[model samples]
Target: MQFSSIVGQGEIKQRLINTVKENRVSHAQLFLGPEGSGSLALAIAYAQYVSCEDKSDHDSCGVCASCRKYQKLVHPDLHFSYPFFAKHKDDTALSFIEQWRDAIIKHPYLSLDIWRGYLDAENKQANINIAECHQIIKKLSFKPFESAYKILILWLPEYLDKTGNALLKIIEEPQPNTLFLLVAQNQDQILNTILSRTQLVKIPCLNDNEVKQYLINEHHQTEHAAAEIAFLSDGNLTEALAMLNNDESSYHDYFLKWLRMCFSNKGLEIVDFVDVLAKLGRENQKNFMRYGISYIRECCMLLAGAGNLVHLPAKELDTAQKMISVMSLPMAAAISELLEKAHYHVERNANPKILFLDVSLQIVKILKFKTIPQGTHYIPN
Candidate 1:
């Protein structure tokens, strides 16, 4: 992946380039960022630049021999390690290398769930096994065959588990001209031994404007649609892309209708609405809950007298204004908390009908009865 092809992160791109220019590249470095922040893509681009036979100051030359191999992820010296559902104890990342290349080349902003779809991963968890760790040790033991440096880009090192400790010796004292690039989302989940040994490169999430532009330019979304999805995605490009297949405005309408039903404490209406929600499928249900959480956060902003800070479209902003008429800051916060918990449960395979019904009742208690928990001060108008 070339740096130019990746979205946003201009400052990060320049900093990575500077490392190569100044000959100060760390042997083991961490590209740490949330999913869809282009962390993995950045690491690959950096590697390409490092190995590019004819690299310019900003990026690798696309036509160069090294660049050609890196683009296809087929380089002799470049290796990839990622979390995989090993079919057999001996199954290594190479066993599934073809799928990995296709999946990543198609979507660099890959999430674990998306990656899971590429495998026969029924109910199995993803991890880098001890076998894979041993393979990493053996691979890095070799010198570069074609490029100036031998590079190993390990994605989601958080999945390394206790087995990751085996690779620490190589990580600390690697062969000459060898580079270890670890890309990950959660720092706390990584083995501390590996975490402390690498230099950290922090990658911040993309702003809404960047996401909006990408949708418009790349995905051919209309300006209005892009704006709405960008706002709803909240800096997750992976989600924004997935949402391209789903209608987000419908989510806004349904969310508002559900809130109004809860406000009225209409039992029959809520149960019927829950039925609709349960049929949205797991991914859609999660996205719907996420949409509600983001929308309520905007309502909270309005309740706190931060209307100017709200990023909702005109219609949703109007709806939020009307909704906040009965919503105190505490009430909106309480509802947001409920939605957050609901989202968590949904991700963990909770029954959607039961989950949605429970959340609706909680919302009724907060909105209709104004029964926020104690210690949360609710001011009366």
Candidate 2:
């Protein structure tokens, strides 16, 4: 993909281009960034720009022979290695190349969960096995086939096991004109040996405006809808894109209703609400609680006389202002803590009905009886 096609990261794009312009391109580098930050896309665009026959100072000429091949991800010089469900000991990333190409081409802000959907990955663990590492070494052993550099873009090197050390020789002393671009999210998970051998390229998450504008211009979402999704996503383009088909716009209303029921301690209504929550599926339940957490934070900010820092849209801001009238900063903070714990449990496969019911009871104790949680002696501001 071209740099023009990737969203945000204007500074990073320019920096990559300047690296090529000044001929300071490193042979081995790590594109380190949070998920949905366009690190993988940047790596591919940089490789294409480096190998482009008719390249300009800004980017690769899309019409050149090398550029054409790179656009389709079929270039002989461009190889890719990524985490995959290995069905056999001999299976490697090349074994799933077709699926990988399709997944990346369609969703450049790819995540492990999304990648799992593209395969028949029932109960299979995704990893970069020893076979793949060996393949990577063998692929780079040859000279460039069509372009000046033979590039290997390895995605999620964090999945590489202790066997990753087998590739250290090639990584440290590679064939000339070979580029090893490793795209990863978690630096702590990568083997120390591999981590120390590469130059670091840090990529920051896209700002809210970048995500909001992309939804408006690309997805044709209403300004308000884009703003809401952008707020909920919190700089994650992958999450923003995933929310496109979801009924995320209703989260605010549903969350408010649940909170109101909990505050009233209406037993039957809460039971029904918990039932609905239990059936919304695990991902939706987590998202709903996340929305509650963020909304409560805004309420706390308003109660603390920091409404200026609130980013809620107009309707939500009005609701928050009204809601904070009855709830003190301490109450809002306690509810937020409950929601945070609920979100954590939801991620760990806690039974949704029991989890939500227990959280609702705790919230009731906080909102109705003004009872501080046993361990947390929150002082009202």
Which candidate gets the maximum TM-score versus the true structure? 1
Q: What's each prediction's clash count? A: 0, 0
Question: For model 2, what is the alpha-carbon lDDT of residue 279?
Answer: 94
List model 2 lDDT by residue over 1-381, tens digit each. Answer: 899999999999999999999999899999999988999999999999999999898889999999999998999999999999888899998888999899989998998767876876723678999999889999999999988899999999999999999989999999999999999999999999999999999999999999999999999999988988898788989888878867754888998898788778898999999999999876677678878888998899899999888979888899999898778877888889899999988766688899999998888887777776757553323
Clashes of 1: 0
Where does candidate 1 stray beyond 4 Å?
120-123, 351-354, 374-381
**Per-candidate TM vs. native?**
0.92, 0.88
Per lDDT, the best of the predicted structures is 1
Q: How many backbone clashes does candidate 2 have?
A: 0
* RMSD from true fold, candidate 1: 2.6
- Which runs of model 2 end up more than 4 angstroms from their true locations? 120-124, 266-275, 341-358, 372-381
